[model samples]
Target chain A: MVLTWAVIGKMTQRDPLPDGTMRHSRRRVLRVGALLALGGTVPSLTGCEPFNREPPPPDPLAPMVDEALALAAAYRDAATTHPTLASRLTPITEAHAAHAAELARITKVALPSATPTASTPADSDATLTGLRELERAAGESATQACLAAPAERAALLASIAAARASHLEALQ
Target chain B: MNTRTPGARSAHAAALTAEYAAIWAYGPIGVRLTGPAQEAARDAEATHRRRRDTLVLRLTDAGDSLPADQAGYALPFPVTDEPSALRLAVEVEERTAGFWQAAVAATSGAERERALAALVDCAVRATRWRATAGITPLTTPFPGRTA
Candidate 1:
């Protein structure tokens, strides 16, 4: 003979009357099904209630990754027009790429795959001004991240922020 | 090891969402960007694509449901000029950084490490944007910025 245990609740209590016999019910089976359903529900729920759900909020890493990617773009752009800075800029761009990869690893998120158009305004003066302005904004973000997160995160942010500082210097 | 837990998986998914938004923001960003900036934009986009693939595998391996990327995403504003583009770039980084910060709180151990790394990465990128924009006081003091 063969014995198989189906997915059912087992309640072998001492026979209330005399000889020992067990009684089973639908309640246990229902409970297990509910757990499975809830497990599936949470992920979907996150999408529905991105703001309300009391789970840990979204990671701050997204901005950092974006910034890193942006920095790479900026540096790469500078390298083309200002070949003098190409060598100096390339490493910085690479650093940003590395930072983006590291962050993606942590968040388990996909990075974008689209290329930017690099549309500079028609005016050369405007182009220079815009570049300067952009650099400042990038630096500010890194500084804010360094200040806002915990020690480990703060330290990491600070280092990246420092790198940005160097970029700013190079731009000058 | 603990990647299967609700907390851990949520963190991972959040990271992916940020990546999605960053990818979207690049379109407008690249338009105003020029030269090496364009190449960097392309490379960044490729990086996101690769990372996105990695994320899908990790989530699936950990028994998590992966979120699908939208065919089109709405931009916060029109990308008419370089200034607007830079502003949008800042906005994207800040928002995405907040998401990763949330993941850090939601997870633990290796998951936590990844979340923290993501958070750090965002913060760093944000700083770079600020610097490019010539904004002072670049970067957030911490990750998971609320405001």
Candidate 2:
């Protein structure tokens, strides 16, 4: 009877059982299984922690587009005073709106909630003069953008700069 | 004569056409616009004339047939009122601007820059017209062209 029991034990321990045998061996198997399960869960756990990592900031061009749109709005308001001028300018005004909308879309920015408030220059004539000055500055800024970057950027900035120059001429 | 690309020729032609239209539009634009605005309109006309003259000479030098001035060209519409006149001005600038944009597409280096500058000038004029009309969004998405 004892020989039979020993034979049975040997048969059950086919995978080089440790000295601890039965209980200890089972425990080690469970531990290995647990480790494998843990290993499988690791990638997802790291993925979940993505919020903990820092993200890069948005492109600077986004804000510049917004500013350009705002300036365009100001121009639109001023254009309304002279209907003949306004009619002449309708297409141009429409074009600016389209540009502003496109830039806003590109930058994934919402249209600015507030309209630009014009602090009226002391006199109407003075205001026109001031507007012209502002136009010149805007033209310079647009030209600078072209000078500062890649071909695509340069083209876009150049277009804006030209608009500014046109404004300066009209104001004159 | 040096061989020119189709794009280059097209752009050159477009710029020339714009010059023609600008020269034509100024007559009415100058009349309707008064005071400082009138002086500006006259100056702009003179600028266009100079550009037109330059293009004619350049085309002639290049052995290309230059387009002659027409006795009259149709405006987008009648320029009877100030509003109509301003609108015409905008149309003219935008049309010219589109040509420059085409030029930019055709040429490179200095030529491209010049085309770009011309486009900007048209756009700027459009914006001024917008401002004069009290509209918002002075610079249009596409300045001189439909697309």
Candidate 3:
């Protein structure tokens, strides 16, 4: 229930980060409040009620599904790029895909088509370091989401955050 | 933990039992190890002890009935050797994590934060145990999840 400015502030002024670009592109602002109103990329308080043509109120968890899929796509891309390390990376990639699937199931949102163009470093060691950073940020996001989420969904969100942290340890 | 709902109270009580058992389980875990690994068990046990104390105090202050710590907890499996012992350590952490994870959905405010933190700690410890045991795919996608 508590949306700190730090979590939702940047996301307030702009469109939801475009799909497929969240991993590569710099952090995108989310139109969070607007997103809760659904089907609107623009952040407007006045535009929600359009004379009985009411869109369903969006699940706050929908954004999380997108985040999970983006992470999965990025990991899959890394596995493809580093074929020698595919054995190590593939399980983690599968884990992210599972997370995305579960989040989608909970939110009842279809998984977006993910065309991740993740650029890995030339070396496997550096690539792992990069992945660890991504995992760290994603972990923080999931923890914040857990704190702000409803009681019914908090356990799953907390598990996701803990998993992200543990996954980073494996990367080391 | 002045639990507002029965669900929250039940979850906390269950987590309290886990904290007690985890601390007790570490004795056997720490004994069957050497060097850094033994130190890790000691540290983990100390952490559980601290959390358990806090929970007891909070419940007492609220005039809530405190859950009893058992005289001793049985090991999940034989811990006669290093590999078995390490496996038991992982089991203890993972089992303890389940209660805290459940608590996250039952409680709110600072209690929920504490539960989330405990779950993350257990998951990280479990990962390290798996790595030490040379287990592949060192992390679970959803720690503490039965499904």
What tens-digit string does per-residue lDDT give for candidate 2 at B45-111?
7877887887677667767776667767888789987778778877887788877766765666666
Error of 1 at B113 (Å): 2.1
lDDT of each: 0.61, 0.63, 0.82
Return whichever of 1 and 3 wins on DockQ.
3
In order, what DockQ does each candidate have? 0.03, 0.19, 0.80
Off-target runs (Cα >4 Å) in candidate 3 are A1-54, A113-115
Cα interface RMSD of each candidate: 9.1, 4.9, 0.8
CAPRI band of model 2? incorrect
TM of chain B, each: 0.86, 0.89, 0.95
Report residue A138 deviation for candidate 3 (angstroms).
Answer: 0.5
* Span of ten consecutive residues with least summed lDDT in model 1 chain A: A1-10
Choose 2 or 3, whichever is better by DockQ.
3
Q: In candidate 3, which residue pairs clash?
A: A11-A30
Worst 10 residues of 2 chain B by lDDT: B1-10
Question: Which CAPRI tier for candidate 1?
Answer: incorrect
lDDT of 3 by residue, A51-96 (tens): 2245666877888887887788778888888899787788888888
Window of ten residues with lowest summed lDDT in model 2 chain A:
A42-51
